[model samples]
Target: MEYNLEVAELEKKYSNFHLKHINIKLPKGKIIGLVGENGSGKTTTIKSILNLIKYDKGNIKIFGKNTNNLTKIDREKIGVVLDDSFFAPILNVNDINKLMKKFYHNWNEKYYFEKVKKFNIPTNKPLKEFSSGMKMKIKVLCALAHEPKLLILDEPTNGLDPIFRYEIVDLFADFVSNKENSILMTTHITSDLEHLVDEVIFILQGNIILDIAKNKIDNEYGIIEILPENISKIKKEDYLKCLKYKNIYYILVDSRLEFQKKYPKLEIRKPTLEEIMLILVKGE
Candidate 1:
């Protein structure tokens, strides 16, 4: 399969944290979500992949070229929106447009302004004066104006209201409508990811614990609540994780149908991405 971005055995070390041998493959025309608790290395992994920070070991390839060797022309094909990174606070919409044009060879000035108008972003107001939601929208719009093949975003929908969130989600859907485009993003908002992503990757304490397609998650994974006394009735291999609270056990099983066939008395329900992550990270 052709991948727009590839990371293999990527490792980075810090005094307090370590990102260990992370591997990811983002196929063309799909959106992948990187999710984990705060301080679990989600942002660290992204920074490493983008070469914003140095990795001690491993390879990163974008558009089939090593990230270390990507030329200015190659870099132009990737758009990025970082959580804490953006243009200077003093730059207004027009000032940003002029500056970006000098940086990106394929920058679409007309498209950028059209988005500005459509989103009703203040053309003359400095970025510092904009609301958080407005700032995020402008950043996203700038990323899209370059018409990149791959979009790397960190919390792209962080501060928007429901209405604007829906619009931004729709815009993302349209971006990957072309078979050549792809997106990789990290968001704390699992609900948005539930509707937007093709696959979800769960990282915990610097390790990737799960990587699965959205359909498989929806169709195969399940959650069951049972009394603590019934725990032994469940085969160890049948369940992926188990959480205990008071007198009840919440179990995460990989195959709902098969587990149901085995234990007909226990109730099984579909597991959401957030629920699954909770179980994996906090369960034993």
Candidate 2:
């Protein structure tokens, strides 16, 4: 399968923090969710890929071209949306549209304004006066107007209302429908991507702890609730991770189908994205 983005042996260090050998693959036509705590290397890894920051080692390739060698066309095909945009605070939405049009060869001026109007964004006011939600909407409008082949987003829906959130998710699904586009996003709201994401990459304390396919997440892994005493009967190898709450123990099992055969008395159910993160992050 062709990959939209690839990272290998990526490394960076700071006085108190280090991101080591971070490797990632974003397959074309899929949405890959980057999951981790606030201080984890999600942003750091993304920054290194975008060359927004200098990395000590490794390489990033977007559209099969090394980031360092990205041509104007290649760069233009990749869209980026960050939580806090670096656009001049004095610039209004109209100014932003004009500026981006100069750089984006595929910029659709009509589509851009249509999106702005659809989202009910004010066109005349300076960006500095807009709320966080409004700012993010403008970023989305810009990213989608150019019809980018790949989207790299950081909390693109951070402050959007539920209706807009659903709209954005559906838009992502539609973008990849052409089977030539993909998305890599880091978000605190895992539930939003529970149904939309094709892959999940879990980073912890600057290290990638889990990278699992979305289908495997749904059909294989599960939350197993059983008495702590029954835990020993379940093979030690079967436990991916486990946590205790009150009298019940939540076990993240490698395969729910197999576990059910071994312990029919236990209760096994599908785990949400948040529950999986909790067990993997905090459980023993």
Candidate 3:
């Protein structure tokens, strides 16, 4: 299969943290959401793919070429926006615009200025004076201005309000409308992504524990609420994981069909991404 980006057996280690055997693929024309808690190695994974830090060992490829040998053409096809702006703090938006035109061969002047206006960033003020959200918007603006084939974003919506967040997410939807474009974004805002992503990859403490299509969760994954007496009716083998409360059991089932077959009369509800994350991380 043709993939926009791929990582295999990726390993990275620090004093107190380790990312082991990380493997994931971003296909052409698809948006994949990377969801995890604060210290789950999301940023580390992204950095590793971009070769920003030295990974212990692994294979990372973009557009069919190994990242180790990424050409200038390959680099040009990818846009990246991280939590912190990489631009010089002393430069204003206009100054950076003039400078970036010399940097990217395909920089779109109209699109760049349009994004600045759309984001309401101060044209003359230094980047250091912009708010966190404003800085983030400017960073995204720069990334998108070059019309890259792939976008790698880390925590893109963390500080923005609802309106800007929704607008940016919608812009992402439009970007991937072309089959050649794709995105791999890590975000804590699961709600914003529930309807936007094609695939959801859940990473926890550096390991990828869940990888599934967004639609499959609604049809295949489910949660069952049962009283203690009925717990045995739903076989232990049927549920992926579960937790018990005062007088009830909250069970997470891998197959809703199996869950329904076991408890035809019981209630099973659609579990949200957040709930699944919670159950996986906090449940027994």
**lDDT of each residue in 154-250, candidate 2, tens digit only:** 8888998889899888888898989889999998789888989999988888888999998999999888888878777777677789888787888
TM-score, prediction 2 = 0.95
> Which window of ten consecutive residues has the lowest lDDT sum in model 2?
230-239
TM-score of model 1 vs. true structure: 0.95
Say which candidate scores most in lDDT.
1
- TM-scores for all candidates? 0.95, 0.95, 0.93
Q: What C-alpha lDDT do the candidate models reach, one value each?
A: 0.91, 0.88, 0.88
RMSD of 2: 1.6
Q: Which tens-of-lDDT digit does each residue in 1-284 have in candidate 3?
A: 68999999999999999999888899999999999999998999999998999999889999989998999878988999999647889999999899889989999999989888877889999988988888888888888999999999999887888889999999899999988899999988898788789999999999998999989997889998788887777666878887776677788887888778867888888988887887787677
Span of ten consecutive residues with least summed lDDT in model 3: 230-239
Clashes of 3: 0
Cα deviation of 23, candidate 2, in Å: 1.6
lDDT of 2 at 104: 92
